[model samples]
Target: MKKGFRFLLKTIMWFMVITFAFVVLFKWVPVPVTPLMVIRYFEQDSEKRTFWKHDWESIDNISKNLQLAVICSEDQNFLNHNGFDIEAIEKAFEYNKKGKRVRGGSTISQQTAKNVFLWPQRSWLRKGLETYFTFLIEVIWSKERIMEVYLNSIEMGKGVYGAEAAAQYWFKKPAARLTQYEAAAIAAVLPSPQRYKASPASPYIQGRKAWIVKQMHFYGPFSYDKK
Candidate 1:
């Protein structure tokens, strides 16, 4: 029993060291691929119907409006939070308990952690692992680095990942050149990108885009350098 405990301790220690090193390495390096990208590629449907769109443009290559728009739409307090938004998480918990509707309280940091290191599914194990990885990145990576990875890694449409890909496919331009409204339009579809079009004006997207623009005006020019 003592030998078994020793083995477990050693194994866990090795995992922490390895994962910590991996996370730190990514702080300076671009992530070539992520777990979700791999899963999306292998989903039999992806080959038959959906073609993946992804290009890793640095955060500096993406527009400032887009940065503000996503922050406004996804996590209003993204710059302020550590890895989790405690108030939002608490609200989500209470909202779920009432069974009124289902809502997610995942902060941008948590979503980045999930997209980068974890798989597509919700389980206690996944959530536990997400929390662990989120804390690690928050400690090791800057807020700009966190946003850079999130914007460049998240799924924008059926198989699209990152700002450059989304801009090219939707707006026929580079991410650096997207207009404020164009950026907001892209941000608006993020909650259900597959369901909503960022162009050609779906009524749902039109309404959300307007709202996101208002939010951007309120959020007012957040460059990640602030953090």
Candidate 2:
């Protein structure tokens, strides 16, 4: 028993050390493959996809509507939270308790961590890794950087990732050119973008878009600028 316990402890320590080393290496080394990128590649059944890589300039550089719409629809307190938003999690827990299916309380940061670094599955082990990566990103990456990575990595559709890809595929325009209504529409389908189309005319899509628009009006004019 003692020998087995010592072996298990050493194995766990080695795993942690290797994981940390890889993370540090990846931070400095730009890899051609990311988890989201791989998923998109598989979804499209093609090897090539366009990714929008933009440096931070102004919110306008990526469409103020997109930024506002996401915050309005997804994370109302994105600017204030430190990686984890306990209040939202508590609310989600309560809401899911009343529902037939379990709901989620993932903030944009948490979503980014899961989408970019982990595989698509729900397990306690995956959740643990997601939490670790979320903490790392929140501590090391700026808020703008987190948003940028999220924008660049989220699955927008069957073969699409990022605002640029979704904007082009859905609206035939660059992400910077997305309109308020279009932005809201895009944000509306985000909960299940892979399964739902962001058509403004669809009843459910329209309703969700309207709700997001209202949220923007309620939460707009507040600066989400964070470091």
Candidate 3:
């Protein structure tokens, strides 16, 4: 019994050490690729499985419009939240319990944690780890760093990832040059990136984009002053 308990405890300690190291490393290093990027590659048809696009642009290089647009559309209280938004989670729980269209009240920090470290799946195990990583990143990385990683890592289209690639693919421009409508269009499709196009906008996307733009205006004069 002593031997078994010692092995389990040592295993857990090693895991914690390794995960903490990675979290601290990412605070200063650009994420080259994410688990989702690899997972999505294999999930596609064999002929197209190799297709992938991602470009890491500094947060300063990505347009402020895209940054604020995502904040308005995905997480209104992103700047204030630690890792989770209790009110949003409660609302999601209530809505899901009612059997309406399922909703996730994940804050930007939570989403960033999942996108960077965890696989894209719905499970209690993944959710638990997601919570763990979210807390780590929130504690270790600044808000600007969090947003920078998010803008540079999320899957924005079928094969495209990050604001830089998404801007070039959808708008034929760099991320730094995206206009407000262009930014909102990209943000609007984030919920279902594979099914939506930022350009040649669908009516549904157009409507969502308009709403996001309005929210961005109400969000008002956004800036991320790195400290």
Highest lDDT model number: 3
Note the Cα lDDT for every prediction shown: 0.89, 0.77, 0.93
lDDT for model 3, on a 0 to 1 scale? 0.93
- Judging by TM-score against the true structure, name the best candidate: 3
TM-score of decoy 3: 0.97
- Per-residue lDDT of model 3, residues 1-227, tens digit only: 99999999999899889999999999999999999999988899998567679989999899999999999999988887788899999999999999868899999999999999999989999999999999999999999999999999998999899999999999999999999999999999999899999999999999999999999898898555422
- TM-score of each predicted structure versus truth: 0.94, 0.81, 0.97
Candidate 1 lDDT over residue span 80-123, tens digit each: 88889999999999999998878899999999999999996999
lDDT of 1: 0.89
Name the regions of candidate 3 deviating beyond 4 angstroms. Answer: 225-227
Error of 1 at 61 (Å): 0.7
Ranking by lDDT: 3, 1, 2
lDDT of 3 at 36: 94
Give the per-residue lDDT of model 2 (tens digit) for 64-151: 7898898888888888999898999998999998998787899999998888678877899999999998888787666776776677
Candidate 2 backbone collisions, by pair: none
Q: Which residue segments of model 1 deviate by more than 4 Å? A: 46-51, 223-227
Clashing pairs in 1: none
Between the candidate structures 1 and 3, which one is better when assessed by lDDT?
A: 3
Better of 2 and 3 by TM-score: 3
